[model samples]
Target chain A: MRISIPVSVGIFLLLLWEMGCRAWAVPVYILPPPSEVLCTALSQYRILAYHGSVTLFEILAGLALAIAVSIPMASAMFLFPWVERALAPFLVASQAIPVFALAPVLVVWFGYGIESKVIMATVIIFFPLTVNLLEGFKSCDRRHVELFRMMGYSKYGTLKKLFWPWALPYFFAGLKVAVSVATIGAVIGEWVGAQRGLGYLMIQSNARLKTDMVFAAILWLSAIGLVLWWLAGIMSRRYAPWKDRG
Target chain B: MTLVSVEGLKKDFDGLSVLSDFSLSVDRGSFVSLIGPSGCGKSTFFDLLTGAIAPDEGRILWEGRTISDLSKKAAWMAQSDLLLPWMSALDNALLPRLSPKKSDRERAMALFCELGLEGFEDYLPYRLSGGMRQRNALARTIMFDRELILLDEPLSALDSLTRQDLQGLLVSLQRDFGKTIVMITHDVEEALVTSDFVVVLSDQPMSVRSSYELIGTKPRLRDDSYVVGLRREILDMLGGHGP
Candidate 1:
């Protein structure tokens, strides 16, 4: 019932938009009707799927790399106060610099290939993941750590048994945020130089005034983000089952 | 024979003394309760004894050996009932066992059942009541296989009825298991009823002001006139000026 309400409203809005576009005789270049967009999506389904899959692969690969790299960086910052101190300024600066500004530099360095796109996505995802994970590590119950010390558990033992498990939920929180913005990083990377991906396809169609195809590409991007967010929610549920109840 | 002894222990925090020239000794298989007012350094004393913090000047001897670490020989249960929130009741009890074997799990389960936590083996700590969590903690302390156990106001958080029940449990565990227990509590009646000796300490720059040996067997009746007089004496020692 909850899901169906918004879905029905969305269909109603699309119908209204189609009627307005046809009645006004609006140029397709400016605003393609939802029906025309749907037709274009079906007709160009094969091309759209190819580029969509490329972007999807980049998003997943970039997120995986970010998660891998962030864990160690976050751990170092958590385990040593001095390391956190040293890296704090640089971390803040990295986040402050717009990732979009770095997209062209990444394209130039890694060449107009998937490597640049993945790196760009990784840069966007890394900051939030590290910050969230460090916060989780630092927030473990002090009494629990004291108990671990009383039991003579080693530092690594405490990290594994207590810190990591305690931080899993926070990791998922950062992952959700990263997943939402992941495609933006990939698309921006593609817009800069990539010969493939939905971003590149949208650029090509827009140059030819094929606005219907551009609208179709955008619908595909929205679907990717929605699917990734849903997958992240499922993973969080599986890993942090204890967090759900009172 | 003395099982544990602290000699001239001194401790300070940022140049203000918490414990000064404090000394104590416990007999083998005896239960001792250190009773005092708040800020009397009972926790600091526990930390010193457990090797959690090094004393400014003192010596702690466990079984005639200079104490470096008590983790192998002593198990401690603090007031908060610090059970890991993520672990099940069974796993929390088995924490002290480094590499828990099948028998270790069975042993922990048996103790858990004995403590009235039979069906709660897999329940998380947050799911259990306050009393049940403390029982789980006690099970974990006992599972450590240590002869000496330190309990820091373990029942101070429970309601009166639950507190009395757990007091009874502690008495039985000491009598049946022959464990040398050192517990700290501010409750004069609790100290007098459950301990073989009550060590009363003065507040601030804390030092042992006096110690008394209680009469009678395990779980002395709280209503007995002799125990009643002892309670008043301990309460007065705790700075009770009220008429």
Candidate 2:
């Protein structure tokens, strides 16, 4: 029933879109209907797949880098108040500067390669992951900490046994947010300057007025984001099954 | 013999005194309960006993020697079970053991059986009932393998019936294992039923208001004339402060 409701809603929306485009006599460049978009996606599968694979690599790599960086950073912040205080401004600044503005600079430095796109994705994914994880660590019950202290547990032992387990749910929540936004970073990086990727394809397709192909690229990006989100959910359930009361 | 003694202990939080000139002693193998007005620093006393916090003034003597860091000497349990939700009952019970071995697991299993949590060893804490979770916490405390156990209202969260059952368990555990226990409780009847001595305290800057030595074997019957009369006296001492 859960799957059916959303599927039905999507189909209804697509049907309405197709009929509206047809009834309005909208030019193909101005508005191609869902049918045209679907046809373009199928007919140009090879090109879409090639470009989509590039974007996928950038998204996944960026997400992996973000996780690697954020976990340690969050841990340091949690373990030492001084580290959190030191990095607090820089962490906020990383988010404050527009990614769109940074993308052009990143492309200039990294030269339109996958590296720049990956870095861009990392920049976007870092904040939520770090903050959520730190919050999770901080959320441990005072009584539990006292119990551990009374048990003669060292700081590292308490972190390993108590804080980490307590924070798993929060970590997963941050991962979900990161995965959903991961594509935006990679795609934006590609938009600024890239030899390949769905975003590059969309730019090329739009310039040539093949709006259907651009829509097709968008569809693939959405699908990739959905897949990443689903994968994170699966991992969350595997690692923190206790959080799943249902 | 006296295993632990506190002399003129004083504690303050930002200039507001909690315990002032507090003093008490627990004999080896005795079950002692601290009953006081709500927020009258009973829990603070347990914290001081465990060396979780240092007393502002005075000294804690363990085995007749002034000492700090009683944490290793005492197994502490708070009102909440403090069981890690992700861990099974057995795993939670084995927490104090840094590197638990096969023998440790066996001992934990034995503790689980004794605590009537035999069938629920593999269950996560969230799966257990409130009483069972407290039993799991108790088992964890026992796993600390310390002679002195300090409990801060460990049974306060349970229903009356469950509380009674655990009261009996605590008494038996103390007797069978020859353990020294100091517990903070608000239940007057519970204090009477389980403790060898009940120390009543006044409101903050809490000091010992009175101490009664119960003269019978525990798990004492709550309805017995002696127990009932002592309960009334303790309640009267607490006055409207009784929880």
Candidate 3:
């Protein structure tokens, strides 16, 4: 509800900019006002839209890849005592190496394509994804656990009823963080080398000092992140609704 | 008729012994209350009888069978009796009975009505008060064909009047259902008023100090002369001199 005021203010600012640019007779290429920006977006909508699609695919693919890997990895960490004990040190150390630092190297090996971008996104998002879920895995109430043992519920049943729910909140929280990281990861990969993308457009627009195009690219990044976060929130609210129900 | 027998039961925690050679036997359908000071092994004995914990040494025989869960004869209600926080009182009570969905709900509702917790069928455990929660726990434990219900100070946290009310209700229900109960309590009067046999326990390294059989009939009497005398004797035995 509070967003209405900020949105109105934002609309007003855009109007002021368009009027200022129109009154000053500024060149469209230098600093396109709101009108020029919107017209350029409409004319080049298909091209920009294609790049937006590519960026979104990279983010989704990275998310899917991280999810597929992290779930099994976290489950192993949960199920097998020794593996978690042994791997904990390595997992902690892996986060020390930043994904931005590795993006260039990934591009060097995989060339100018989606493979590198997806890998970068996975690297950026994987740690939180695994750690959040793992933290959830370990936080089960001992009382409930003892009750399960007393009832003669096997390990699998305990996992299904207790451990899974315990971890679900953390999993969704991780997913929210991962959404933002994913967008950043996609942009980072594009910044290094890309034929087409919002990130590449940002780079090109900034070189020509076209702040409007750069802002538009940034707007796309934020919109994607917001949509993904909103989706995560919806899923959590629908499924892991224990908190609200309480 | 010996319903449950605990012989030479010894439980050691680290180097300290909590219960040493503790032995007791309850007649069939007898309501025995273990009366003791806090830290006495009354709870441990109840735990052993109910198969909540295995005794370090010796054996417990329940109804001619070695104390085991195979026949599902016993249920334990602890001092901090836990209910599934996610479930309603009705559902909580229905836990042990475990039937098909439709039948289970009907039975749970019936049990809730019987226990006087009829209106709070869908409310979670957190929503219920302490007395109401215990009522639910009691219903849950006895919902199955539970022969022995181990009550570990179930009403210890309630107000004095509330305790008295619940105790009277327990006695009436026990008479109606004929459940063999082994309850642990520090209150001497509580034991004398509700139980058929009361086992007095010594303070630490606890063993039976004395035992008394209430010389009263069911539909019990709190103010009966025998109940009053036994209650006084038990309280005096615990070192708090009776008026």
Best by DockQ: 2
In terms of lDDT, model 3 sits at: 0.77
lDDT of each: 0.89, 0.91, 0.77
On residues A1-246, what C-alpha lDDT tens digit does candidate 2 reach at each position? 989999999999999999999999899999999999999999999999999999999988998899999999999999999999999899999999999999999988999889999999999998889999999999988888988888788988999999998899899999999999999999999999999999999999999999999999999999999999999999999998877872
Which tens-of-lDDT digit does each residue in A1-246 have in candidate 1?
A: 989999999999999999999999999999999999999998999999999999999999999999998999999999998999999899889889887899999999999999999998998898889998999999888767877887778888889888988888888889989999999999999999989999999999999999999999999998999999989889988887666753
Model number with the top TM-score: 2
Candidate 2 chain B, run of 10 with poorest lDDT? B43-52
Worst 10 residues of 1 chain A by lDDT: A237-246
Q: Who wins the lDDT comparison?
A: 2
Each candidate's DockQ: 0.41, 0.72, 0.19
Q: Candidate 3's residue-wise lDDT over A122-236, tens digit each? A: 8878888998998898887665565555555568777866688778888999999999778888888988988777888889888988777776677677788899999998988
RMSD of 3: 5.6
Which of the CAPRI classes, incorrect, acceptable, medium or high, describes model 2?
medium
* Chain A TM-score for each of the predictions: 0.94, 0.97, 0.84
What is the per-residue lDDT of model 3 for residues B1-243, given as tens digits with 9 covering 90 to 100? 888787778889887899888777878788888877776667666655545577789777777666653125566676665776655677667666434378777877887887779899888877888788888877776665566767778888888877887898678657877878888877777877888888888876887788887675764677888777777777888885221
